[model samples]
Target chain A: MMNSPICSMLDIEFPLLAFSHCRDVVAAVSKAGGMGVFGAVNLSPERLREELDWIDAHADGKPYGVDLIVPNKFAGKGEKLDTGRLIDSIPQEHKDFASGILAEHDIATDELDRTRGISGNFARNLRAEGAASSLEVAFEYPIKLIANALGVPPQVMLDLGKQHGVPVAALVGAKEHAVAQVNAGVDILVVAGGEAGGHCGDVSTMVLIPEVARALKEVGADTPILAAGGITTGEQMAAAIAMGAAGAWCGSVWLTTAEAETNPVVKEKMLAASSRDTVRSRSRTGKPSRQLRSPWTDAWEGEDAPEPLPMPLQSMVSEPALRQIDKLSQSGHQGAKDLATYWVGQGVGLMNQPLSSGQVVQQFKEEFAEAFERLSASLGD
Target chain B: MMNSPICSMLDIEFPLLAFSHCRDVVAAVSKAGGMGVFGAVNLSPERLREELDWIDAHADGKPYGVDLIVPNKFAGKGEKLDTGRLIDSIPQEHKDFASGILAEHDIATDELDRTRGISGNFARNLRAEGAASSLEVAFEYPIKLIANALGVPPQVMLDLGKQHGVPVAALVGAKEHAVAQVNAGVDILVVAGGEAGGHCGDVSTMVLIPEVARALKEVGADTPILAAGGITTGEQMAAAIAMGAAGAWCGSVWLTTAEAETNPVVKEKMLAASSRDTVRSRSRTGKPSRQLRSPWTDAWEGEDAPEPLPMPLQSMVSEPALRQIDKLSQSGHQGAKDLATYWVGQGVGLMNQPLSSGQVVQQFKEEFAEAFERLSASLGD
Candidate 1:
């Protein structure tokens, strides 16, 4: 039954929350017992509107949420720059580094200059000002929750959440951040550990969970925590719940699922690779992020590599190059395939099989019950 | 009863294993419900024998274990270097770097040179050839378990365990290491994650436990796993067990306990530290290990810092300096106190109080029950 406060708060059967960029995954996971949160970082206001509209149709009267990157602080936050200006502001050396990596891999670089114009707009939307339009579009839909990552939920998001009567969640990788989010009137804390797929801090979920839980108690805040990191199996979900997390918030486990829009080559790499294959480097986002290791990441980590530029700029440089890599790899380019990588957690080692989102949810339930039964046996005797 | 296969195998009521360097802590925890495994790294053969003799007299018929650093590979594995020969082999620059840091703290570095003579023997003893006498001394006692870290239990230790009817356990940080340990016939795997104190791998316990458990299953091994990392609470212990561990192996949780031989100044620092206060660096040991963040660790991680020497050599350089830091800090040297640090996991945040070892074991039982009740309530409906 997994009757957590979060389950009731979100009006979902299970407390499990799946975060994915693909609308199909969000709809499918929500249609299962778990709630799905669509990551709308790169999605434009119009694009988010379209994705949510699709989710509304496919979600089968189930609740879903939206996640955005309205960080409390970032590079070029206050400045108003058009997509072209933002792309132009990126260092020439950084652009050359990105293009050179692709060139060395024998892939096309022509599409990167184009991808910037598109991804550039999304990168600008990462600020509260830019994200406001997207959130306004999201509020028009029936989103059960709204979340912010990389920092505390901005005041605009908080005020908007209050006005709409929707819970506001913030992702935190450390105990202090969790306390800050709770103080900022965030309703839910996505206490992610260092092993989480995208942006993350250095602390692990095992330590961070209890640390956040205790800090909340000390601060007299009762904010429910959703443990996120290398959670793949139902037992891990159960383990998180046991360690003071109200539920489990999983992202990487779904990337290998059948409903995921994950690049096929990268998915295959994840299936074959050990947990050691992922590197937490700032090359992609100018902030530490866990991703599958490939020649691209290796080159960035190499001694001769240039320092990654800050936030949106790093994303601007990387997203375009990676998008083309995905395209070429899918089109049967061996060099592109060799250089392909994707955001994933250490849990990639456990996600060996490709299941549907529904099947994954079902397994989580069954495995969860089995884990309890195992615990009961050991504890009972 | 917190009974599992490990409990029955180790003849303890609870599966919680307290790892400490102090003989009193080992005896006190063994006297309680949990088994304490003494860290036997720096203890000389005669010193370890005397410590075990004290534990035997005070353990009140409870089980205890001994842990040594018998790496499968190291810098001076086959070398026949005595204490003086080993001390002379350390690079002058590294010695200067460590001592210079102490001098900058306005603390005396005079004792460092003398401490190295003693620590040099311990560093040399980390390899199999030098550890043979220590193991022979330990075998003379009524120890229930024998364990090794940094690598697989050496062939000599494994053979000795087979002959002596003692279970040989090995500490591993990754799934591959766990499989290798099982193949090497290690009866128990202390799966210490990156968040653990002392020598560790980069994988967190939450990820490593399930990963190692699955790997062991694939290899058809039924070795019991003691999950070690940022485990400081009963709920975390339960979570470890829920995530396929037999029990929890904790070290940092005890450093703040009343019985711990932790330096007084350092204990206060740990009590006040946040989970983020620990730094995982290769400054102290040749390999990466988590320790409290201080000016000492800060200097090593700085841009101008020299590369840490390999395994026994790094230990030779840092140990002597740190030992003097501890002494000066204890004598009320503010600068020394500011620069003082010791090995501790990220779980230090939860260890705020100075409870006795017995009280800690009792709280763990109560906490375990409460954690289970919490899990049951969530799943009961």
Candidate 2:
């Protein structure tokens, strides 16, 4: 295997970093020689502990990591608002708008009423106190790295990473963000472009990766960067490595994998989608996240539609409705099926079939080799 | 020098195709051993002939090409509407909204009134008959290639290209589009992503280039692909080539070159801007085109703003006001300076300095060499 610095640092055969919320996909990828990093934002402390314990049992002695949502700012941030206070803060108008949309699709509003007071996991985990508890549980396991998704890793998180001898990573969408992360002592930079599945900036991967790489080198920072966004194939990983990324950090590609926890309806939709099917809308998480374009997104973008609320508040309004949609869509509800969508990159167009996580790892290995050969062939004598 | 099929086909020293509207940039880039393609959408047949004559006089025996906007679908496309009819068809509300915006900036509305009768070159040339005139003028010169910006090249264009021993290229945003073009007998594919200047689709270059290449290969098509979108530097060029592109087709990077006709105020803003400074808005072109985000775009995106009219109609509304803004901004008008924006890609963030066209090409060569060396070194024994 072609070795990169990140491969040695993370103790993986390849530098590919698979980001997934499902424990099975994570363990399968790790066991297949690529390091799997479990996304822990939606998990409670007890649930995270249980998941990590399971990974520890089945990871086959391969090093794996964890990702957390520790943003610098969120609703009820510095004021330290509890879950109940946060739920109480949501406006009735926003709730009504959510229920109205579901009711239009013939979905019962009773489920939303029951879940209204339960609060959302994203809202709960994004706050300072909530993220701290998750971080505490994460460090108890042997994580090779820990990543912060929304912004620069907090000082406490950085300090904890240092104490545990684990490298800290942060995702950046621009060159200036990469510089700030490096200055903040981040060990790795996940340079994601706008074409990435979740929250992203407007820059595309082709430009952002090399721009960040050059900026880091100009500042004399030796931090390794993992290129993300619209990179599903091994050929793309090879291209990113050629652009100065130490490895490929993938997220959306795993959503269609056989062992993934992705809703089967959404998975099928993703399998049949083209790159243009995704739109970067603030409807999902109150941030611009790329998700499949559906009647739901179209309605949010319509003339009379209310502007989506910010961050956790928007997630609060969207999650319950979407959860119900997924449940009904699986049972063949036409309206729910039409409105069902999920967060995915433009690479979803290329993901036409379902493969086991291990099979994806093997395919990545073979494609990486072929891409290297192609590059070598291009350098003619 | 490294050679690809496109390099030999175009008889250029490098596989870099510089797309520009300025005659000076075209001649200079061609003289510097790279293929320079003149963007002919904004010029009349007589003006195109004049520009091509200028390029022919100064190109020093080097070959160049021309790009035209001949989309399959446009306003008044199949109806054969005259300029007066098309202008008369625009809604009064849109015209009033556009005029009010300029009036708020303290610019005189007289220039707009005078130009109201004159149809925009974009609106004119996008029609079949107008494009035919432009093509006739283009073929009078020693052009090596003719490209369609928004869709498949018309049958007449393909036939003319074959008769003249020149290649016909079409820019596409998706692999499906590439397949359609190949099936339509397009000689070359310019696979551009959402980050490209002018008109572009939602796919990022990193995914689109490889996807198109693989799709073409699967279908046994030998069409060469030129990767575009947010590709400003030679390192990015190397990355694209590694991803399966035969060459790099660049546009935004040339706008900041010394010979470019970009408005001075907007050029300064582009130099100081980051990737996030640009937004894809339909306010200017009636299509989703990426340009610098200014008060003008923000106002159009506001709640009270009318939905932007389609293509030529929106261009009709915006062109007059923007022309006045650009002219006034150059003369120290603060409001005009604030409102002045231009079509550019996210690559503007990396363009920090103004270099002559020859200098830019020389830098591309040096950067391309360094990137190749870096890739070679990574494949260690």
Give the per-residue Cα lDDT of candidate 1 at B82.
64
- Docking level of model 1: medium
User: Per-residue lDDT tens digits of candidate 1, residues B1-381?
Assistant: 555989888998888899999888888888888999998888778888889999999999899999998666666567754656666777888878888888887877766663364465576576566689888988998899998976887788988898999999888888887888888899999998888887778888888898898888887889999999998888889888887888888899889889898999999999899889999999987788899999999999987788887766787788778877888789898888898899999888788888988888888888787778777889855
Global lDDT scores for all candidate models: 0.86, 0.85
**Positional deviation of residue B322's Cα in model 1 after best superposition, in angstroms:** 1.5
Instruction: Check candidate 1 and list the clashing pairs.
Output: none
Write one digit per residue (lDDT tens) for candidate 2, span B1-381.
355878878888888899998989999999998889999988989899999999999999899999998888767776655767667878888877777877788877876752443356665787788888899999999999899987888888998999999999899988888999999988889999889887778788888887888889889998999999998888788788877888899988888888998998998999888877888889887899988888888889887788888766787788778888888999999889999999998888788888998998999888776776666665555
Cα distance off (Å), candidate 2, residue B6: 1.0
lDDT of 2 by residue, A130-234 (tens): 888889999999999899997899888999999999999899998998999999999999999988998988799988988898888899999999999999988
Q: For all candidates, state DockQ relative to the true structure.
A: 0.69, 0.61
Candidate 2 yields a Cα-based lDDT of 0.85
